[model samples]
Every structure is written in structure tokens, then in C-alpha cells.
Target: MLSETNKKILSLAVPAAFSNLFDMIQVIVDMIMLGRVSPVAIAAAGISMQFLGLLYAFMASFSVGNSAVVSRFVGAKELDEASKTTFTSSVIAFLISIPFTIFGVFFSKYVFIFMGSSEEVVKAGETYLSIISLTFPVIFIEFALYSSLNASGDTKTPLKIVVVANVINTVLAYTLIFGKFGFPALGIKGAAIATAISYYISFVLYLYVFLTKKSIVSFYPLFVKDYAKRVLGIGIPAGVERVITYFSFLLFVKMIAEYGTYTLAGYQVGLRIEGLAFMPGFGFTIAAMTLVGQSIGAKNYEEAQKLGWQTAKIASVFMGFMGVLMFLFPQYFAMIFTNDEKVIQEAILYLKVVGLTQVPLAIGFVLSGALRGAGSTKLTLLINTASLWFFRIIPAYVLSKMFGNVLYIYYAMFVETFLKAGILYYMFKKGYWKRQVKWKT
Candidate 1:
């Protein structure tokens, strides 16, 4: 019933979706374990995760650029070029992550205090953030390899590795946090240690895959300046976009924090739960990126456009269904992460409010990936930065000040998603990306 093109999309998308889901599970597990500790624990860990997220956002440039370049090479049947790009990208990723890792380890306490947390939250977050920071280089290296494999049309290997790593994280967190099986109870420190261990293991597994020649790309370390330049040239805009976007998001988080500790914790819980909807959207986005990049490399421009739209159509269906479930069962989902009645109530409101935005969010996700895959990262950078500040952040800030209720802030988020989705659809249809990129490879 499905064409080969459609089947190819699913082949890449399904495994990638599961991988993203498992990745989110790692964070959700942290929240769940910490939630049992205290509401303050939840708030503290949440802030630490957000800071880590900022670092990931910056690293996204290398991943996105690497995917675009490497996918094009694979499509063109240039395996040697693809392998060189991967090694250079990985090296760049490791180098850039070092500074952030050092900053996070040394200045984590100051970061929490600047986040306007209570004294208990600041102390707890300091411990968690400092421990987690040790894994920044490991995470970047793992992600570089992960993205390379996906671009080369091998998503299943990464998926398998992530599932096993997630299991390890869960079991370790349970034993360490509760002092089971000869482990001493270390509270937040224990959770952070579990997280760091799992990341290192995942990196090692990825390395093994490359070294064994099981992967499409090999693990030989190379520093190709031309390749690195090309990758960064394509990625810098996306990276800059991420820096601005995350900064804006942190401001949004600060606004939510103004309400109180319980509200911040509830917001974090809702975000972790809503991450369920994001996994499929992200997966399909990868599918679009890979398919479109390959199609363009073969110079089949129409097929590239068709694949992009097809990916968006499928992603919207899954995301829309998730929205319905979130709208109907917000309370049940909220309860999984926290027992505090106040936190539960706030999370319920957030889920109910955000549930309606899923479909548009899906379109935004897949289309942007398509554009970036075609080396239109600059376009995405402009659109995302402008829409975030104009439609989301500024309005949310004004609403937070004008009304005592947080409901207006949630409404602003919905409006931004709707507008951004529409703009992305228009850009994709106009075929600007095809004209904008002149492939250097």
C-alpha cells in the first residue's frame, strides 16, 4: 500500500522517533526520581536541566551542519567525504563543549542563584549541575556520532544503544538515590552521578560502533579544515539561532519563576510530560532532513519538496493525537512526576493550555528541519529568532506583568506557535531554500 518513498521515510523515522523518545525518557526519569525527594528538589533539578539544555542548543549547530553535509555526501555516493566530515564535526563538537563544561562545573552555584531560586533550591541545583557538567564533552561527542549515523541512513543502531543506556540510567538512579544493592544514599548527588555514568557509557557504545566499522562512517580522527569550514559555514546561523532562542526561553522560565517554587516545579513537570509529543515531531523532522538532503544531492528538487511535505503530514497526525490525550488527561500525566497538590494543579493548567498547539508545532518542526537539510539554516535562524522574540517572549513578558495570572503567558505561547507554523509553511511552498543554497561540496 505504501510507495518506496513513503516506506523509506518510515524506515528512517520510526527508529529515530524511538531514539528521541528514549532520550527524553532520560530527563523524565531524573524528574521522577527527584520529585520523590522534594518539590524543592524538582525545582532545583529542573533549573539544572534547563542550563544543560542551553549548552545542547549551542551544540545543535554542529549536529545540524554535519547532518546536512554528510547526508549530501552519502546521497552522492561519496563515502570518503562523508567520513571526513564526521570526524571533523566530532572534533569541533568536543572542542566547543569544553568551555561550557568548565563553566558549568565551576559556576553552577552562581547560575542557580541568578535564576532566583530559594536558598535550598540553589544549594541542591548547585550540586546537581556541577556533577552533570562533567558529561558535557561526552554528550557532544555522542551526539555528533549519532547525527552522522542518522544522516547516513542508519538510525536503528543509535536507537538500540539509547534504549540500553536508558535502562542503565533508570536502574542506577533507583539504586543510588534510594541506597539499594550496597549503594549509599546520595540524594541529588546520586541522581547526577547516575546521569553522568549513563552518558559516558552511551559515548563508549557509539565509539565502538564506529571503530568496529559497523557504521557507515568510520571513527578515524581527522581535522579537515575545508570540511570544518564548510560545516561551520552551514551551521553557524543555526547555532546563533539556538543561542538566541535558548536565551529567550530562559527569560520565559524566569517569568514563570516569578510565581513561586511550586509553579516553577509544575512548569518543569509539564514540559517533561509534553516532551512525549515532541519525540515524534523530532523524529519526522530527521526523516525530512535526511530525505530532502539526499533528494537534492541527486538533483531531484521536486522529490525533495514532496518528501518534506509528506513528512510534515505524518508528523502532524501523531502530534495532534498527542494533543488530544494531553488535553483530556492532563491531571493523570501531571501526577506521574509529583505528589504536591499545588504542583499537580499548576501542571494540569499548563498541559491543558499547551495541548492545543501541537499540530502547528509539528509543522514548524518538520519544515524547519527540511529547510536546514537543504542548507537554509540562515533562513531558519532569521525566522526562529524573530518569531521567538516578537511573538512569544516579548508578549509573554508583557502579559506576566499586566495580569497576575499565568494563563495569559500560556496563551502567548500558543499564538507564537500558530504564527510560526504558518510562516514556515509559506516559506517551504515558495521554494526559497532550493534557490538559496549553492552546494559547496
Candidate 2:
């Protein structure tokens, strides 16, 4: 039987996992609406949406570090330190978003061009990126508040807010993108607008949690320049790790783009569904990070390791069950996103491929999250970047060359997940991460 702490972790992980599933549903809904226009429209939206994820990649840098610090403080029962870290994290997130926001607004088109998308996709993407970029600071700040709150064991608030926001996004995406509700049909651009508005709504909800709720981390007045570096010390490497991984994935997308529109659309849809499996893993990952960071802060390395493995076990069980559903119901699931037979067939192929990798993916995410909570971003950087490029990206291209099958290409990704999980598990067991970070926060 799970203990009280295990149950507490689930209370956090379940909400977070459900939150990710909602996001995946949101993506499917977006594609279902967009797919009616044309396959090109769907692919264009998917590619641009992905390009925006690059921006999210940057946001994660500050947020990840902030969460690590915040979680540790909470674990240590250091309320003042946690609150101070929250304020510092907000300021740091704002500072980091400035240049990216500017570039996204001014050169949205050129950036898409650089990403090597088609002329049509680039033009459509510029609209999506420009509008979405406007919400970067809002999104990051919202992320900061949510991470801080969740670390304090308040996952329900973020989940509730995100669900409400996604519902707004859903209705607006339908009305604005499809010319319903007497709104101008803005197509992909309309979807971006809806998303931005949702982020604003979420920001308001986060503001409430911090303001109204009695949490360990409350926003404070004193702003310190030194705090930014302290936040970035852990954040920068974590961010760099993500950037490398994103760039590699971006390259993988570019390679797949060369194949055709159907392939890209199928891959895009399948990817979102696949995220559902890993997202449950991600929920536990968040728990692992929070528990480990806080445990270490309390000077309880023994508790940290115990929390880490417990989280991993829960994640594995959940993901394994989800994998069964994914493998068993591929066609039924594919239909939720698109009706195009060809697209559905391709998506089903990727879904089944994902099933085989779900357990490994769970381990990789949960263990890595635990390691990051230990403030060992450099190790994560090396493990993720190396396996991503070596096992997945390179082999994906080579396999596509050999067989011309996207299934074979995804098989390479499966291999990469196992490799990452294996290596990370070993490092985590050895206890090197416990000493790597000297963070005072």
C-alpha cells in the first residue's frame, strides 16, 4: 500500500498529469478545427505552433531553476526563502524574455525562414508567432507563479486555472479561427490570439493564488541584482540543455518536413498524443523535483532519494497502463484529431511506436526531474543532448534513409529513451548530483 507521502505525491501528480492531458486535447481540438480548412493549413499550424515552443523552451530555463530553488526552500520549511525566491524568479523571467520577445515580434517571418519551413508555412507562422510572442512575459510570469505554488503543494489551483483557460481558448479558437460568433476568421492567427488571451487569464489566476492564498512564497518588495544570477546559476545550464534538445528536435522536424505534408501532420498529431504518456511521467517528475529539492534543503539526502524512487515507481505504473491503452486503441484515438484516412493511418503508426517507449520515457523524465531538483543540470545537459543527437536524431535520419518509414524513424526515438533512462538511472544511483549544486537558495 502507498503511504501518506505517496498519496500526497499523487494528489500533486494526478492534477499535473490531467493538466497535460487537457493540453493534448487542446492541441487535438486545434487541429480538428484547422484540418477542415486543408491539410496544408493543419501542417502550417502545427509547424508554427512548434516554432512557438522554442519560446517555451527559453521560458523553461528560468522556470525550471526557479522551481528547483523554490521547491528546496519549501521542503526545508523555509517560508521566507521560498517567497524571496519566487519574487526573484519573476524578475529573472521578465529579464530573460525581453530579447526573445523583441525578436519574435520584429522578425517572426525571418525566424521561420531560418527554421527552414515552407514559404506558405512561414507566412502563416509569422502571424502565429507574432501574436503568441506578445504573451511571452505573461506566460513566463504565470509559469513562475504556478511552479512556486505547486512546489508549496498547491497543484489544484494551476490545474483548475489551466482547465478554465483551455476551455476559453477552445471556444475562442473555434469562433475566431472558423469565423463563428461573428468574429473575423483569422485562421491560424486566430488560434494564436485565443492562446494569448488564455495565458492572460491564467496569469490572473496565478496572481490570485499568490495574493490570496497563505503560501510559503509570497511576493516581496526588495529586488536584488544578485538574485538573478543565483536563479540563473541553475537555470542557465538547464535552459542550455533544453535549447540543445529543442534545436535537435527542430532539426528532426526539418528532416521530416522534407518528406511531405501528410507525414508532418501525422507526426504532429501523433506527437501530442504521445506527450500524454510522458506527461504523466512529467507530473511525477515535477513531484520528484519538488520533493528532492525540499528534502535536500532540509539536509535529508536519504529522504530525497526515497522520494525520487517512489515518484519514479508511480510514474512507471501510470505510464505503463497508459501505454496499454495507446497500443490497444490507436485508430480510435487518431480519429479524435483528424478524419483524413491517410493522416489517421500515419498517426496510428506513431502512436503504437510510442507505446513501446512509454515506460522508458517515464523513467527518463522522472529521474531527470529528480536530478534537476538536486541541482545537477550539467549532467542532464550531457545525457539529454548526447542521446538526443546520437541515438535519436542521427539514427532517425539514417533509418529514414534506409527504410523511408516514419515507424522506423520513431523506433530510433524509442532507442534514445531507453538509453537516456539507463544512463540517468545509473548516475542518479551513484549520488553524484547530490554534491554538484551548491545553491544557497
Best by TM-score: 1
| Tens-digit per-residue lDDT, 1-441, candidate 2 | 979988978988888877777777777788888887666567667766676677778776778888888787787788877788788888877877888789878888886687677888788878787888898788777777878877777777778887998899999998888899788898887888888888888888788767765555788745656666656877788888887888887788877777788888888778767776777887898888888888888888988888898898888889989888888898888898889998898888888888877788888999999988888887888888888989999999999999987777788988888999999989989999877757564
* Superposed Cα RMSD, model 1: 2.5
> Which candidate achieves the best lDDT against the true structure?
1
* lDDT (Cα, tens digit) per residue for candidate 1, span 1-441: 988877898899999999988888788788889888889888899888778778878888799899998888888888888888999999999999989889889988988888789999999988898998999999998888998999998989999999999999999999988889999988888999998998999999998998888987876567899889878988889889988888887789888989999889899899988898998988999999998887877778899999999999989999999999999999999988888999999999899988999999999999999999998999999998899989999999898889887888899998999999999999999999999767755
lDDT of 1 at 289: 91
What residue pairs clash in candidate 1, if any at all? none
Q: For each candidate, what is the lDDT?
A: 0.89, 0.81
TM-score against native, each model: 0.91, 0.90
What's the CA error at residue 429 for candidate 1, in Å?
Answer: 1.0
Report each candidate's C-alpha RMSD, comma-separated, in the order given: 2.5, 2.8
Name the lDDT of candidate 2.
0.81
